[model samples]
Target: ERPNNSRFSSCSVGNISAVLDAVRDGRKRDCLKEDAGAFCGNKIVEVGEECDCG
Candidate 1:
Protein backbone atom coordinates (compact mmCIF):
# COMPACT_ATOMS: atom_id res chain seq x y z
CA GLU A 1 0.00 0.00 0.00
CA ARG A 2 1.20 3.49 -0.86
CA PRO A 3 1.51 6.17 1.77
CA ASN A 4 -0.84 9.16 1.71
CA ASN A 5 1.61 11.56 0.12
CA SER A 6 0.58 15.09 -0.75
CA ARG A 7 0.95 14.32 -4.44
CA PHE A 8 -1.81 11.72 -4.33
CA SER A 9 -3.76 12.97 -1.32
CA SER A 10 -6.60 14.15 -3.56
CA CYS A 11 -6.59 11.40 -6.17
CA SER A 12 -9.31 8.78 -6.43
CA VAL A 13 -8.69 5.04 -6.40
CA GLY A 14 -8.94 4.77 -10.18
CA ASN A 15 -6.60 7.68 -10.65
CA ILE A 16 -4.06 6.16 -8.27
CA SER A 17 -4.31 2.84 -10.09
CA ALA A 18 -3.65 4.55 -13.38
CA VAL A 19 -0.57 6.24 -11.93
CA LEU A 20 0.69 2.95 -10.56
CA ASP A 21 0.07 1.24 -13.89
CA ALA A 22 2.04 3.87 -15.74
CA VAL A 23 4.89 3.58 -13.28
CA ARG A 24 4.84 -0.19 -13.49
CA ASP A 25 5.19 0.13 -17.25
CA GLY A 26 8.17 2.51 -16.77
CA ARG A 27 6.55 5.36 -18.60
CA LYS A 28 7.90 8.93 -18.19
CA ARG A 29 4.44 10.29 -17.46
CA ASP A 30 2.36 10.16 -14.22
CA CYS A 31 4.12 11.70 -11.21
CA LEU A 32 7.54 11.79 -12.89
CA LYS A 33 8.24 8.13 -12.24
CA GLU A 34 11.52 8.34 -14.09
CA ASP A 35 12.85 11.09 -11.87
CA ALA A 36 12.93 9.10 -8.63
CA GLY A 37 11.26 5.68 -8.93
CA ALA A 38 12.72 4.50 -12.22
CA PHE A 39 13.39 0.89 -11.48
CA CYS A 40 12.86 -0.03 -15.13
CA GLY A 41 13.25 3.42 -16.69
CA ASN A 42 11.45 2.59 -19.95
CA LYS A 43 13.24 -0.75 -20.20
CA ILE A 44 10.21 -2.92 -19.48
CA VAL A 45 11.79 -6.07 -20.98
CA GLU A 46 14.69 -5.95 -18.53
CA VAL A 47 14.31 -8.00 -15.39
CA GLY A 48 14.35 -6.93 -11.69
CA GLU A 49 12.44 -3.70 -12.17
CA GLU A 50 9.40 -5.04 -10.27
CA CYS A 51 7.85 -1.62 -9.56
CA ASP A 52 8.31 2.17 -9.80
CA CYS A 53 6.06 4.72 -8.03
CA GLY A 54 7.70 8.14 -7.95
Candidate 2:
Protein backbone atom coordinates (compact mmCIF):
# COMPACT_ATOMS: atom_id res chain seq x y z
CA GLU A 1 0.00 0.00 0.00
CA ARG A 2 1.20 3.52 -0.69
CA PRO A 3 1.71 5.87 2.20
CA ASN A 4 -0.40 8.96 2.42
CA ASN A 5 2.48 11.19 1.45
CA SER A 6 4.16 9.07 -1.17
CA ARG A 7 3.33 7.17 -4.33
CA PHE A 8 4.66 4.15 -6.09
CA SER A 9 4.39 2.72 -9.60
CA SER A 10 4.57 -0.67 -11.19
CA CYS A 11 6.84 -1.54 -14.07
CA SER A 12 5.25 -1.72 -17.50
CA VAL A 13 7.80 -2.57 -20.15
CA GLY A 14 5.34 -1.68 -22.91
CA ASN A 15 5.09 1.88 -21.61
CA ILE A 16 8.83 2.15 -21.15
CA SER A 17 9.50 0.92 -24.65
CA ALA A 18 7.01 3.34 -26.12
CA VAL A 19 8.68 6.25 -24.37
CA LEU A 20 12.13 5.15 -25.40
CA ASP A 21 11.05 4.81 -29.01
CA ALA A 22 9.42 8.22 -28.93
CA VAL A 23 12.60 9.77 -27.57
CA ARG A 24 14.56 8.18 -30.37
CA ASP A 25 12.09 9.82 -32.78
CA GLY A 26 12.16 13.12 -30.86
CA ARG A 27 8.46 12.95 -30.18
CA LYS A 28 8.14 12.38 -26.47
CA ARG A 29 8.17 14.70 -23.50
CA ASP A 30 10.96 14.09 -21.02
CA CYS A 31 12.15 15.13 -17.62
CA LEU A 32 15.64 16.16 -16.52
CA LYS A 33 17.70 14.17 -14.11
CA GLU A 34 19.25 16.07 -11.25
CA ASP A 35 22.33 13.83 -11.07
CA ALA A 36 24.48 12.22 -13.68
CA GLY A 37 24.23 8.53 -14.33
CA ALA A 38 25.43 6.25 -11.57
CA PHE A 39 28.91 4.73 -11.57
CA CYS A 40 27.52 1.52 -13.01
CA GLY A 41 25.45 3.32 -15.65
CA ASN A 42 28.31 3.86 -18.08
CA LYS A 43 29.56 0.27 -17.80
CA ILE A 44 26.18 -0.84 -19.12
CA VAL A 45 26.01 1.82 -21.82
CA GLU A 46 26.40 0.63 -25.38
CA VAL A 47 29.32 1.22 -27.73
CA GLY A 48 27.48 4.30 -29.00
CA GLU A 49 25.61 5.80 -26.11
CA GLU A 50 22.64 8.12 -26.41
CA CYS A 51 21.31 10.91 -24.24
CA ASP A 52 18.97 10.49 -21.28
CA CYS A 53 16.43 13.10 -20.31
CA GLY A 54 15.32 11.42 -17.11
Candidate 3:
Protein backbone atom coordinates (compact mmCIF):
# COMPACT_ATOMS: atom_id res chain seq x y z
CA GLU A 1 0.00 0.00 0.00
CA ARG A 2 1.08 3.54 -0.63
CA PRO A 3 1.62 6.07 2.11
CA ASN A 4 -0.75 9.00 2.45
CA ASN A 5 1.89 11.38 1.21
CA SER A 6 2.61 9.45 -1.97
CA ARG A 7 2.17 11.32 -5.20
CA PHE A 8 0.64 8.20 -6.75
CA SER A 9 -2.15 7.95 -4.22
CA SER A 10 -4.56 7.63 -7.12
CA CYS A 11 -3.06 4.25 -7.96
CA SER A 12 -4.90 1.05 -7.04
CA VAL A 13 -5.18 -2.55 -8.23
CA GLY A 14 -7.70 -2.07 -11.02
CA ASN A 15 -7.04 1.57 -11.85
CA ILE A 16 -3.30 1.55 -12.38
CA SER A 17 -3.64 2.07 -16.11
CA ALA A 18 -5.78 5.10 -15.53
CA VAL A 19 -3.18 6.53 -13.19
CA LEU A 20 -0.47 5.95 -15.79
CA ASP A 21 -2.58 7.61 -18.43
CA ALA A 22 -3.06 10.60 -16.18
CA VAL A 23 0.65 10.81 -15.59
CA ARG A 24 1.33 10.63 -19.31
CA ASP A 25 -1.16 13.37 -19.95
CA GLY A 26 0.40 15.51 -17.29
CA ARG A 27 3.81 14.95 -18.78
CA LYS A 28 2.53 15.92 -22.18
CA ARG A 29 1.18 19.17 -20.82
CA ASP A 30 4.40 19.82 -18.98
CA CYS A 31 6.69 18.97 -21.83
CA LEU A 32 10.22 20.22 -21.39
CA LYS A 33 12.81 21.62 -23.75
CA GLU A 34 14.81 19.15 -25.79
CA ASP A 35 17.90 19.78 -23.71
CA ALA A 36 16.15 18.90 -20.46
CA GLY A 37 16.83 15.19 -20.96
CA ALA A 38 20.58 15.70 -20.70
CA PHE A 39 20.35 17.23 -17.26
CA CYS A 40 18.23 14.61 -15.56
CA GLY A 41 21.06 13.22 -13.47
CA ASN A 42 22.54 16.48 -12.29
CA LYS A 43 20.74 16.32 -8.95
CA ILE A 44 18.43 19.20 -9.66
CA VAL A 45 14.70 19.35 -10.24
CA GLU A 46 14.37 20.93 -13.63
CA VAL A 47 11.31 22.12 -15.50
CA GLY A 48 9.99 18.74 -16.57
CA GLU A 49 10.89 16.68 -13.53
CA GLU A 50 9.54 16.35 -10.00
CA CYS A 51 12.84 15.34 -8.37
CA ASP A 52 16.45 14.48 -9.18
CA CYS A 53 18.49 12.98 -6.35
CA GLY A 54 21.46 12.04 -8.45
Q: lDDT tens digits, residues 1-54, model 3?
A: 436635544446447775567678784444334663546677779887898877
RMSD each, Å? 11.6, 12.1, 9.1
Model 3 CA deviation exceeding 4 Å by range: 1-38
lDDT for 36 in candidate 2 is 56
TM-score per model over all chains: 0.32, 0.35, 0.28
Lowest lDDT block of 10, candidate 1: 37-46
List the candidate numbers ranked by lDDT, top first: 3, 1, 2
lDDT of 3: 0.63
Residue pairs with clashing backbones, model 3: none
Output the lDDT of residue 11, model 3. Answer: 43
lDDT against the true structure, each candidate? 0.59, 0.57, 0.63
